[model samples]
Target: MNRFALNHATTKFWDQREAVEACARIGAGIGLWREPVAAAGLAATAALVRDAGVAVTSLCRGGFFTGGDRAAIEDNRRAIEEAAVLGAPELVLVCGGLPDRDTGIDTARARVAEALAELAPYAGEAGVRLAIEPLHPMFASDRCVVSTLEQAVELAAPFPAETVGVVVDTYHVWWDPRVFDAIASAAGRISSFQVADWVTPLPAGVLTGRGQLGDGCVDFRRFKTAVDAAGYTGPIEVELFNDVLWSRPGPEVFAETVERFARHVA
Candidate 1:
């Protein structure tokens, strides 16, 4: 099953073209980010992947809907269009967190649902599924209100399977007590499955501290087994957001990621 895919965030410092080529060389799929794709020019990036025969499993993001900005919704529509241009079937959405300290989480979560209701049809029409990525609870205050796989699944439930789904990123959900049950419940709703280990003593902002596979406490095989039991037969993307790995050469990191995936995830 060609299950190994590398998410661009893992190699944040690498040039977009070089990263895509590296994935192509290994016959692996890639998860692209919007900023780099825009920097390379959407058409150019699309052509680059097309010529290299690299599949774009999903786009990095397309949400931040709690800010009361009409522009956020417009931006997501554009993201859907970009995913279509890249022949990617999934557009990952990191639903934004509380708008302010005074704003309640319930309000923020409701806004996410409202935004999805508006965008789901557009995504379906463009032949892309909106994958809600539930960031960890640590990010609940400033990054994402969708803080658990269960929340992601529930938010996606009201939409059509082809229109909305959830991302099962181990780094974010591994600590959850009910994660296994959540994965099983996700079943056909899992649009993307990303892996990254969990490490201790987080970095300053806690943004780039994701551990490399086999480096920390995640039980990747358990996750793989559960997802498989739930009927997921798609790519398993390795998406580590770590500063240490970003300092090394892109190929070196990519090679190591493949080795680790074989040892811990595949």
Candidate 2:
């Protein structure tokens, strides 16, 4: 189905070209990362995807605005430009957690809002939406201070729906009891929808432990229904950070991801 997409991180070692080609063959969208894209040369990457007729669903990340400094804002601007070049409408933002030696989480989140205010207009002019992705609460201290969909929605409220949006990632928000309500409120601003399962007994590095669909506890169909009901009809990207999947051949992992998506999500 062309409605499905594969986020490049799920097959970490796969070269970006190969991954894009595979998704192209099936008419699937792709979620690309800034590093690999930069490594491959921006013009080349942009042409490759364009020639292949593949849609770039969204950019992996572009935020770490705890400082609200010029550097962070400039970098995020670059990311928005990159997404625009690749014809990606959404540039996902993983707002940074507490800055080093800084213990105030509230302040970190406030900086995110301030940073968005500075960058939203630039993003809108570039034809890209800044999608605020709220990570699970466990990441509140180090990775993302916006740890709930509600908070993300609130952060995005100030800007136009086209300029600022919120991402719905199952691995990050499935545990919250009010996720459905948040999704409903995100009616005009649901930028991207990502699917990943949650398995218990996290590995030593929990970041890489997101399970394959159907291999964990997430209710994929339920989320799908909720998102659809909320009026989101865009590509559903499968993003898994599992180490086991990354260790396999990219083609193999991609095939498995497609199959699982068919069974659990599609």
Q: Once superposed on the true structure, which residue ranges of model 1 sit more than 4 Å away at CA?
A: none
| Model 1 lDDT tens row, 1-266 | 37999999999889999999999988999999999999999999999999999999999889999986799999999999999999999999989988987879898899999999999989999999999999999999888999999999999999997789999999999999999999999999899999999998999999999999999999999999999898898899999989999999988999999999988888
Q: Give the per-residue lDDT digits (tens) of candidate 2, residues 67-177.
A: 767899999989999999988999999999888775588788889999999999999999999999999998887889999999999999989999999999999999999
Candidate 2 weakest ten by summed lDDT: 100-109
Could you estimate the TM-score for every candidate?
0.98, 0.98
Model 2 stretches with alpha carbons more than 4 Å out: none
- Residue 261, model 1, lDDT: 93
lDDT of 2: 0.94
